[model samples]
Target chain A: MAQGQHHIIPIRMLAIVFGLLLFLTLATVITAQIDLGLVNVPLALAIAGSKAILVALVFMALKYDNKVNLLVLVLGVVFAVVFLALTLADTELRGTIGITEPGTTELTVEPAESE
Target chain B: MSSTGTTLKHYFVNHEQQFDAAKLGMWLFLVTEILLFSGMFVAYAVYRSWHPEVFAQASELLDWRLGALNTVVLLASSFTVALSIHFVQKGENDKVVVLLLMTLLCAAIFMVVKYFEYSGKFAHGVFPGAGFEPQGIIDGKDYSKYDIPFAPQFFSIYFVMTGIHGVHVLVGMGVFVWLVTRVARGHFSPQWYTPVELTGLYWHLVDIIWIFLFPLLYLI
Candidate 1:
């Protein structure tokens, strides 16, 4: 509170943000219950990211603390995101599924059938 | 400077540096933990995409309402754990003890919830082996071929990931108990309260792990 005592974001604002996180998560789950195609993961991540930012900035009191620590924390999440993205790209690119382009020879090797 | 002597000045300086380094080091370690768990999350995502039906069936088998409750409990405990650190920084040992107790109680409740959930799964033969029934979907209709929740392989990963997380919760409870004992014995002060700070980092790691796990395991 010392650092942000004079100009810190209001506690009420934080409380509202937390409340919103709960509601958004609930909404996301309900939305998932319905078929939303491929929007589910990204939508869910959006809600999670919002909630995470709130927890980090407010409940964890990173706002009152040093900015360096907060940046380090954010960097971790960013790196995780990048890691997931790259892995997904690798997996998707290696195995082309449901795609039939010209001059395409897609190999579908069944592990069990190989034996 | 062979680092052989032990004067108060030298000790204090070393302690200060180590203590300061501890927080940063813990943060880096936490980042690594996040990335490690992220692997499971990615695996879960890819499998779910490929086997949406089985994953959904498996999710329905889970007690999601209980999972939601536990999630809130953890989020609240993070608040208390943070407050414990705050009290320590402000030279409020009594408050720190109260917050620590609350945090420990929250952890106990988490474990209790998890115990019931696991026991229920065990009762349903949810474990890997012949117990697992594979439910494959055909077209967009109801094709109940064994109706296995995800694949047997998927269940294995689920158990491993959640099982590891459950261990962390137990570890957190143990650490909380230690904090409570030390607080009761008047061990922490504003000048020397590294335990509370370090513990906060650990609890936050627990919370962060759940933040990812909840969605990967339940929501989607």
Candidate 2:
């Protein structure tokens, strides 16, 4: 191997990132306990996304690593998002293409009561 | 070049090229890992949206306290793994071994907690698919009331996601044990700690997936 210099992350920085991650975990739990109605799922996901980014960027050393590696990760994430969005588009819109107008119910059975 | 004690492979011009190639390969592997989990995530999304109320009520049966505990456990393990990489680069094999041990311990704890949670659910006869027959009382709550339509789907998704994640944890533990042995034998140095670095990245990805799973399965 060529004599390549490796960047040593400071102990203090690692400690701080760890602390922040723990704090965010606590935040997500507390926020979940409260009823946020429409914002609940998005809120939980946002917190998770932030935590994932921190782990990827700092804990995994992507922040200080080569750009090519970062590009690989970013591409992976982008494709995952594409997979989600396109699939959801199809699933969520199932049976909505009829000429009798969307939102029309074909089955007369009442939906089961939940809870 | 002799000062660093780093060996250059004949196939590569220098260590930087070799390191970059390895790192990129790991990232590609990580991408496949992400896609692998994405299929489950898609299933989760489709089912949850289709049966929001059922998903919500069924999720309530899960103990978030245990989930939170595991979350903390995984995050701490991820921290220790990261620290291990840092120490490896500093040529502190002793610290690396200790940190790797800590990471392994955390993974064990997470699995143990999961075992208890699974046992509790099983005791109530709550299972995925056709086997679901939730009965008896758990934590003063009546499990018998969870027989609503689409409830099975919720439990199915839950079991599949967590079960796979647990398997990953086990795999990580195996890798860490191997790493500990290698470190103890003085096999790693500041010059070539690629295994430690790659293993850390894999562990962090495990942690990241759990970060999403915790909220989606337990809190939501």
Clashing pairs in 1: B54-B150, B133-B148, B134-B148, B135-B147, B135-B148
Global local distance difference test of model 2: 0.90
lDDT by residue (tens digit), candidate 2, A3-115: 22788889899999999999999999999989989999999999999999999999998899888888998998899899999999988897745435433666444555796
Best candidate (score: lDDT)? 2
Cα deviation at B112, candidate 2, in Å, is 0.3
Candidate 1 regions exceeding 4 Å error are: A1-25, A33-35, A96-115, B1-19, B129-131, B134-146
* lDDT tens digits, residue span A2-99, model 1: 21122234446545655765676677667767778789778877777777776776765567655667778889888878877887787667666654
**Which candidate leads in DockQ?**
2
Task: Report the C-alpha lDDT of model 2 over B1-220, residue by residue, as the tens digit.
Answer: 1323246678987787887778889999999999999999999999998899999899999999999999999999999999999888888899999999999999999999999999999888888889999999878889999988999999999999999999999999999999899899888878788888899999999999999999999998
Model 2 alpha-carbon miss at residue A46, Å: 0.2
Clashes of 1: 5
Q: Per-residue lDDT for B2 in model 2?
A: 32
Location of the lowest summed lDDT over 10 successive residues in candidate 2 chain B: B1-10
How high a TM-score does candidate 1 get? 0.78
